[model samples]
Target: MPDSSAERPRRIVARREGPMLVEGPVEIVLEDGTTVSSDRFCVALCTCRRSRIFPWCDTSHRRHSPAARPAADH
Candidate 1:
């Protein structure tokens, strides 16, 4: 077995209104038992489920924002 602490840490960058950037290549298991992976040097993971490509960001979060959303009438 390998020591987890001894391994170099993977970096993740969280954006305020968008996807999180992670160092790749990474493998992920979904809630439905499906798996996904990316071999890119970096990967953008959707924090918001607005992605057409789930787990992978498609910049869909940019279409609407908390600040940009229209206010509901009282």
Candidate 2:
């Protein structure tokens, strides 16, 4: 029989310039007492304060470099 304690341990990854990745399913309780849950295998928690989906990673942390921006017409 498989050892119950051998199950994968939960992990959280922090990035200096991006969101915090967390092993899910996870539930977050806000200061307002609201609850949010994510059942994904991994969840990206927003750190840039720019996500449309607050507290979640919407990939808004990507750099808006000039090369990545659309060219303006002359």
Q: Give the TM-scores of the predictions, in the order they appear.
A: 0.79, 0.70
Candidate 1 local lDDT, 21-43, one digit each (tens): 99888887899999898888899
Q: What is the C-alpha RMSD, rounded to one decimal, of candidate 1?
A: 3.7
| The candidate that achieves the highest lDDT relative to the unseen native structure | 1
Writing each residue's lDDT as its tens digit, candidate 2 over 7-72 gives 787799987777999988888887799999988889999887788998898887685434556889
RMSD in angstroms, candidate 2?
A: 5.4
* Candidate 2, superposed: residue stretches over 4 Å from native: 1-9, 64-74
| TM accuracy, model 2 | 0.70
Q: Pairs clashing in candidate 2? A: none
Off by over 4 Å in 1: 1-6, 67-74
How far does residue 27 in candidate 2 sit from its true spot (Å)?
0.2
Worst 10 residues of 1 by lDDT: 1-10
